[model samples]
Target: MTVNSANARIFGSDADAIYLAPIGTPLPTGIDSVLDPAFEDVGWLHSDGITEAFTGSKTEIRGHQGARVVRTRIETPGTTIGFHALESKAQTKGLRYDEKEVTVANGVRRTRRGAGQKVSARSVVVDVFDADDITVKERHVIERFEIVPDGDRVFTNSDIAGFPFLGEIIGDYITFESSGLATDTVWNVSVTGTPTGGTYALSVNDFSTAPLVYNAAASAVAAALNALAGVTGLSGITATGTSPTVITFPSAVTLAANGSALTGGTDPDAVASTTP
Candidate 1:
C-alpha cells in the first residue's frame, strides 16, 4: 500500500471499509468541491473474483467475483503502552476509465456530443488503530485482477500463494505473452499441459468465414504454431490435434491488445501456462 505524510495517524491500521462518516451537525454528505456530503455511498468496488469490471483495479482473487478476500497487516508487530495512538486510518484504491457522452445538459436543442470516462478504486490503509495490545485481526481487502484476457499465464503455487496474488492489481501489467508470434485479434487464451511438440488442430467452425477470413485453414494456423516452434523467437508456438491438448512452441503472441472474447467457449483453464 502507498503511504505518505499527509495521512500518518491512520498509516498503520489495516484499511477495511471506506465510508464518509461525516463529522458535523449538517449530516455530512458527499462533497463535490471542498464541502458537502450525503449518506454513506460506495467509496470503492473491488472484484477479487466475480465482477463486471468495466474499469480497472489490481487483485488476486478466485471463486465468485467480489467474493474473495485478501488480508494485509498495517499494524506493525510489537507494541508499547502510551504509544502513538492512531486517530483514523483508511485505504483507498483509485479506479479510472473513459467513455463517449454528452458534455452538458439542457441549453441547446442539438448539442454536440463528446467522449469521456470515469476512474475509481478502493483503498485499504490502516485506520485509527490502538497502539497498545488489542487483537491481531487480519484485515482483508477485496480487489480484482484481470488476466488481460489473451495469452494469460499458467504457473504452479499454493492455494493462497497462486500466481494471481503476484500478478493482478496492476492496471497496465500483462500477465501473458507468446514467446514469439503475437496475434492482433483473439478472444481468450489457454495454455494446455499436453505439450504438442509441434502439431495442432483448430475449430474452423469457431470462427466466422464471412467476407472471407484470415488463414481460413485451421490446419494452416496449426502449421504455423508448428513451423514457428523450431524457428527463432517462435519456439513457443506448438501445433495440436482436433482439440489442442498440450502444445509448446515459440513464446511470441500478442494477448491483450488484440484479443476479443473467446469464441465457442474456449476454456482458458484447460491451458497449462509456462515460462517463456
Candidate 2:
C-alpha cells in the first residue's frame, strides 16, 4: 500500500479495509488468496512515525510515505518521567497486572582521545519491576513511558515489553497522542488532588489559546484538559514548555460529591485561560 509522506495519507485497500470492500474488489498485495494464518502481529502501517527520505528530486525519484514517530508527553511538573513502555502491572496504576520488568547492559568508554589508545568497557545494568508475571496472562505492551528525570534519553519502539490498553494510548500516553498533529500534537490533560474551595487554572501558556476556568478551587484541573479536544490548531495545547499544566480540583460539593469546576467559558477558552 502507498502512503503520503507529509500528510501521512494511506492508499490501497488493506486487509482491515478489504473485508469492508466489495467482495470482488482487488487487493494490491493479493492478501485474500492466502486464506488463513492472518499474520500473528497486525500493524496498520500508520505513520509509525518512521520516515522515508528521497535524495533525488521529487520528479525523478519514487514517492515516500508511511513514516511517523511516537508522540509523547507528561502531565507532571518535571521532565523526569516520559514516554515509557510497561510490561506488567508494577508500573501501571489503574490497570491490574503482575509487574513490569526489563534489563540492559551498560559500559563506559575510554576513547583514544581520553589519554588511552583504546576505550575501556564498563558494565552497568538497569532494571524496573513494573510488570513480571511468571504464571498468568502473558502480553506485550507498546505504550510510551519515559523516566526523563533519570539519565535515560529516547525510548524506542523495540523496548515495548507489552501493550497499553491493547496498544491504545491512555494516561500520559493519551495526552501525548491526542494533541492535534499539525505543528505539535494536542494533549487533553487530567489532574487529581484533594478538592479545595478556591478556583484554579492551568499554570502555563502552553496552548495556542489559553483555556482557563475557575470557580471553586477544586474543579479547575480537569476542565482545562477537556477543552483541548475541539481546540483548532496545534498552537493551542495544554502543557507549557518545560513546566506542566496544573489544575486544582474544586473543594466545594454540589448536591452530592464535589462539583465540577470545568463549567462556563467562552466558545473557545483561549488556551491557558480556563481550568479543568
Which candidate achieves the best TM-score against the true structure? 1
Give the residue spans of candidate 2 off by over 4 A: 1-51, 54-205, 208-215, 230-276
For 121-180, candidate 1 gives per-residue lDDT tens digits of 222111122122112112212232222111112334632211111112323211211111
The TM-score between candidate 1 and the true structure equals 0.17
Cα lDDT of model 2 by residue, 1-276, tens digit: 987443333322222111111122332221112222221222222222212222222222333454433343333322111123233332222122222333334743222222212211111111111112111111112123221111232357765443222121122311111111233223333323433232334432222213333332223334344353322111222233211243322121111112244334432121221332
**Each model's lDDT:** 0.26, 0.25
User: For residue 196, what is the lDDT in candidate 1?
Assistant: 24
